[model samples]
Target: MDATPGVISTLFTNAKVFTGETETTFASAFRVTAGVVDWVGDESAATGDITVDLGGRTVLPGLIDSHTHPALIAGTAPAAECFPPAVTSADDLVAVLRAHADGLTDPDAWVLGRGFDDTKFPGRRMPTAADLDRVSTTRPVLVWRCDAHSAVCNTRALEIAGITAHTPDPDGSRFERDADGEPNGVLTEIAAVGAVAAFIPAPTRDAQIDALVGLGEELASRGIVAVCDLLSTRIDDPVATFRTAVDRGLRTRVALYPGWDPVAPLADLAAGDREGQIRIAGVKVVLDGAYSNRTAWVHEAYPESCDHGLRLVDDADVLAAAEWARRNHVQLAIHAMGDRALDRVVELFADAEPWLDGIPSVRIEHATIVSDDYLARLRAARMSFGIATHTVFFFAEYDGYEKALRAEQVPDAYPIARLYAGLDPLALSSDRPATAWSGADDVMLSVEAAVRRRTYNGIDFGPEAAITVPQALLLYTGRARLLSPLEGVGQLAPGFDGSFAVLDRDVFTVPEDEISAVRVAETWIRGERFS
Candidate 1:
């Protein structure tokens, strides 16, 4: 149950509390008054209105996922689960959809699913409309790629969206076609996919709220207390939807970075007074797509193809967004994954240095591929940008990346340690749903990948990029605040939000491989236990 404002207090004792600043720091007890930590000290000095023994459990500041898409996930909750690590083959994917279609009562309603990785399929080829048609020719179907940058739609869906061979490919995106000039139902990038997505029935506001509420509890159960909802404006009126979620009892604190497009004008969303557990911290701008989909806009050509990935946004648009964010006193969280994209972003930030004052630090989402020269350029520019990346992708989509990029580039894929070495206040996150793996949302899984530097198949992609257990923990806990404007979080100090995760064992002492298997015995948020 939630504590009534200003009337609740509790004391947690007999636990090893990791303050998150260092590996050796520990406290035996803490008291929460209302929703903030009132005191933290030895067990003998603890006192509160309500006291409970923790039985020597290990506790740490509640985990914060620096980047995620809760609204997008909620909006697509009706879709069937087609993420990799769950369904490995095209046939398995079809079976999952068939089962989902059979259970749906609406025969004519569109069937939607997300998180399908063609690279994981046995044939290593994306599923086409014909593949989905095998499940249902009558019902329109659209399944998003794991990257969410591309998608495959069934014939019915294509017809419904009016995407034909004659339809001109939108700028920065294209429609894959057959040799005979027919739409193959494969849409790449936001421009192409959004064209079809615009026609899909929008979930009701209540449904959206319910999806967020359910996801909040799910995240809380996994020991996540807050999330930086990257791309919050993917849905119309994200601010209102988040407000509704809070009213409906969302346990996780959210900091929103609505996507910034000059055409859309998100500066208005950043205006007005901030509300409880929800704030527009910045603007999100995507300069490129995912590497797994071969659209990351890298400097070099892919292994098999003589083509570097695609650049989704123009330089002029990115510069304009950066300037707008700076003027509005908000952070600009640019998504630049590829080497070429990072180069462009670094150049743009360097140019925008004049207006950067008074604004929160800029953030680069998914700095997946970085070279030594790129790092030197970033350091030379001395811009106030932080990196919020994911190790889950390194493990989940290792095969696809390995197949696409040069063998030498594999070790530098995530570059977790290297990012920390250059970018002060670096943070880590699981770009869940955007990643190929179903466990992308799991903190332990991300921690394990970051620490072990190994893929799911135990392939060492970038052992040199690995960090210590404490350093990895800081990415999700202590250092997360650098990526967002959320205060009184990422620590257990006095006046901080009384949020912490009670673990079954001390993760700091556990064997590295055993990290992912560690469980959250309980999770508390704002003076109340939710999971």
Candidate 2:
């Protein structure tokens, strides 16, 4: 239960508390009153109705994954998970899907799975319709790539969607082809993926709520109290879905950003939309694809071909999105993963006036390839911008990046140290299932990647770009909150939210290579023992 104004304060003492005020400010005790922080200092100076000893554990401010796709992850709960380590090879993937298909009571029901990184497959081969046909020829099978921008369906699945040799590719997406004109079952971008996904059955409202409640517990266990559902539109009627989920005991606070579709925009907000822990915060536009898939719009062409990748949203589309955000008094988040896309974003929004102050006017999601020139232009621009990038992307999908990035562009990928020095409100997020790695949302994994600058294959990505433990923690905590809609969060200072996590081991003292081994023992939210 949430603490009230008149509630007696409880002092938690004898712990190493990092107040998030600065890298070196350690307090021995803290008092919580009315579900918010009241004081933090030496244990002898603390006063409260009751005192509890933490036995010298390490406590950090509640973690904020400023960019994640929890709503989409929950919405797709019915599908079998096919993420990496467990499903590393193509044989492993086929076996997992085959088992899922065998357990189906309904013979004709679609056999669905997600999270496969073709880049990690031996020889970098993607799964095809023929590979999925081994699972079940009669039943439709569809499995998504780790990036979530694409999928590969079995022949039956393609047939159900009426996609064949005669079917032209959708407006902004493509179907990988064979020697002839037939689709090889690989669908690129949402338009092509949606062609088959529209046939897959969506979960009912009750199921949606149940899944969200479960996901909330999982997040709490990982010491996350808040997240931004960057792509909430994947769920039908996101507002009602999240509202019901929260009402059904979901503890994590969510900020929803419905995708902006030029043809079919989100419905106008109702009274209930803005009244609860879950609320619509902004609009998201997919300006480009991800690096792992070799579709991120770039200035340089892909090594062999003259293909410079794709531009999902045009200048006019972005301008219109900016206008809509201004009219609705919300933030505009552009998914610009490539250098070219980043340049275009600045050009589109640089002259626009902000709707509010104290926070960024616009946000760039996955500025994956920001160069020195781009950073200089950003600093000179009139508009205010925040960036939500990922180290997990390079850590998990290094093989893909090894192929996609030119030798000269390698260091420019997620320059954490440079970003830390140059940008305010710059955050490092997991991007979860969209990332190729298993347990992608685990804060420790991203932390280790940032500190080590090492990849899954044990390759040194960019050692010079690495940062210290304190600087990385600030990115996940205090600095991250600037991009969050939740105020007074991501800190342990006076007047801040009384939410924090106790770790099983001392993360700051752990060896650089062992950082990912640290675990959360307790997660407290609003002065309550949550997990």
Candidate 3:
């Protein structure tokens, strides 16, 4: 349906419209005027210049991914995909990568393959430099582990980085060594991965902009109208790059949280950049690594391991990041995935008042583990903090969680129900390509995982904490908005942006087990069809 901004209007009828926070949760129809929701009520009362029947499909407020990494996804793409349920073994990985390398035209092009999980393999064995060398001898090869926390590279890539037996391990990260203390090409954590990755040619600005445009279409297919790039500064110029992508028809509205760097700060936000579809909402500080690699900064040691996990940032650096957000009049987003890191954040913010109001002062990217005392302390703190947690983490990394978490800690992992009842701005988001699952960005997959509390392999994660459909929807819509700096979004009410998704089936009535199979049929943005 097409409509004039202030004159012509469009009425979408015969739908189970969920106006997230409207007078009625379920409306039969909605009217879009001036490219925004002008009215939403019973079909009998909807008056507009044009009417289109929706055939009784389910319509929801446009979905939001509160903590995805689209720029990261785009940046890592065009590499040979190495994620499972296809690449099941180390042998399978070698075959897939070898085929990818064989297909490439450039003999010297970096053979980059990402997404492989060795934990799910027969003996929990990771592929090594020797295994990757079978794929190529001349070209540099670096394949990231499914968790994105570490990577294993071929000898060529290692040699190119100038890493050898004598190179000392960086704090919180290391290069896995062999019997003779030789760097074995297993780069553990971002510091190790970047050593070689920084040598790879940066994607051309045009290539990156093109990738963003394509990523937007991909997002629209999943019913996402808005997303937050949790770590955007990984690119050359995040703000400008995303702005260009939006101008070039990137469908998803993006809120960027450039990584906090004391030495190299983000360019000052333009007045216009502070309040648009593409905006610089804040800066991100990754406080720790993830659980899959046993790097989540847990309070206790992993089973059979003395490792308590890696805390990547120091207190001074994190406080400095907070100061930057306060000084720049933006928010601070912290990636704290373990109880120890969460304790650090709770301690850091407990004494300070919220730097901003209306929006959350601080956004916790992954509050993976929270205790009763931790929750109470966070609530008692003067600073307001929101949580953007993920169920997909457990869904995709079940074996890792099984290995890393103690028996008593299992129920506490992403306890969506507890967080729902306790946190106001709490939302569930897909960490995406960063996750091991192939369709980690699929909203229904995460919803099913949350509601069923089951892993992909049918193991129960924490069924006692499962929530209802409506609650999960709010995390992806109404409440998810609280995690974003973008305004006038994540709702279907009169004043909200005219963006929504039409589902192929009634999600509210679907069998809990079948929810993962549900698909989005249509998406609308600003009262116009998106996909």
Candidate 4:
């Protein structure tokens, strides 16, 4: 019961300890000393200063979210929730916005909301500024689509941003307008959204830290002991924010990858500061946009659309960034979703293979729409690459993918089995607020989805793409550790960090569909109980 680090000794017995490698093998007990596993064996061989029984519960490696945007999620905490799960129609969305704006004392303050999916609306139409204008004409309102690739602003918000019929669209993005050349209040891609985002009030450093600390506790409660903050610099100083969060008693370990915009400061940031629970792992680059928003840069066009998705970063820019990461000996986490984007990324890696000798492994974030040919190319190249993907999107937002992609493409939407086909290391993540459902952060929910390949509507999306429970679990545990530069974590073996989660039931023994129902009874990080 005394789950604290720096204890002389602690023994955990009478539990099924899943080693994260195989499902059939287990140890009944483990001994921890000074935040490290001293020994793991049968109950008869256990020895420690204090002992407690787990009552035949299950224990596994503390979960690691290989890819997530904790900083962005925290930033959105102060905003109103207009996600599809909460609001189904444009009227419902307007009501939520009105309620949020009404609760705000500042009449002039912007009312911001996120996670809106117009595809799920009763009319299957995106909400326009006109729809939001129905909520409030005085208050400027901004709401992001679920993918964060698009957004809708009220007429007041447009006026505040100085966006008018004469305002030319930013490069790489477009402003949806009516037939008469009037701004429709819908903005697509980051370039367009950033224009209006400049007018929105930024969160204070103290507020950012608090939001991060709260997020850390939330992760710990879900049995997440560590996370790779894929995009860390949404705020001013991400490193300082993470350090402050740790100082405020955030037990979750963090590995940060700052944006690779200028590309000069990355080497210094990676070399100068490597302290506390945070480390600068590498640089992050977005090669393309999200599939849900019809901007994933696919080789083939969407169902009825003439053009493929957008490519956010140029191909040359991606290669140059890779070269810089290679020279600096850091990882390059490229966000690529469509086949074209992945192909370009694979080619870049292939070209940079010799330079990648001592560098950290390159990562492909959200490799959602990979093709077999590209997968073979990746395999043939024999490069040190990692695929950090999510099944939460498959379960939560398959409807959107179904609407945009061809029926044949749906089978490979996430492609967990195919990604693992060549025995490549795969790391699963939630992508948090970007996901379709509220339970995106729940590892068990993702596990069940990956194993069952079922969507929220109870339809089988891709049965052949389904993986076993153990394979899915490894994506969050052993396999995930390969993506991380951290050591002595993500396993329950001797010499590993004494971090593990005690589950209310043995997930390995339960039916696959019931995996999400499994709850974490206790979560320990560095032998200290966090939840």
lDDT of each: 0.83, 0.85, 0.86, 0.81
lDDT of 1 by residue, 379-411 (tens): 676567678888898789987887777888876
The TM-score that candidate 2 achieves is 0.97
**Model 3: per-residue lDDT, tens digit, 1-531?**
233455988899999988777324888999888778988888887678989899999999999999888888667665777777788788999888988888888777888888898887778887889999998889999998987779999999999999999888877798999898998889998888988888887677888899899989888899999998888876777878888888899868898888877566556667776777788888899899988878889888889989888988899999988888898889999998888999889889878988887788899988887767678888888889899999888898897788888889887888899888888888888887788788788999999998999998999998988988888988999888876677877889878888899999888999999998999999998889989
Q: Which is the better candidate, 1 or 2, if ranked by lDDT?
A: 2
RMSD of each: 2.8, 2.0, 1.9, 2.7
Cα lDDT tens digits, model 2, 167-199, are: 898866898889998899999988899999999
lDDT of 4 by residue, 227-316 (tens): 888778777778877888889988888888877774344545445554457877777898888887788888888888787878887766
TM-score of each: 0.95, 0.97, 0.97, 0.95
lDDT of 1 at 365: 91
Q: Assess candidate 1 and give its lDDT.
A: 0.83
- As a TM-score, model 1 comes out at 0.95
Q: Single out the weakest 10-residue window by summed lDDT for candidate 1.
A: 351-360
Model 3 regions more than 4 Å off: 1-6, 22-24
Q: Which is better, 1 or 3, measured by TM-score?
A: 3
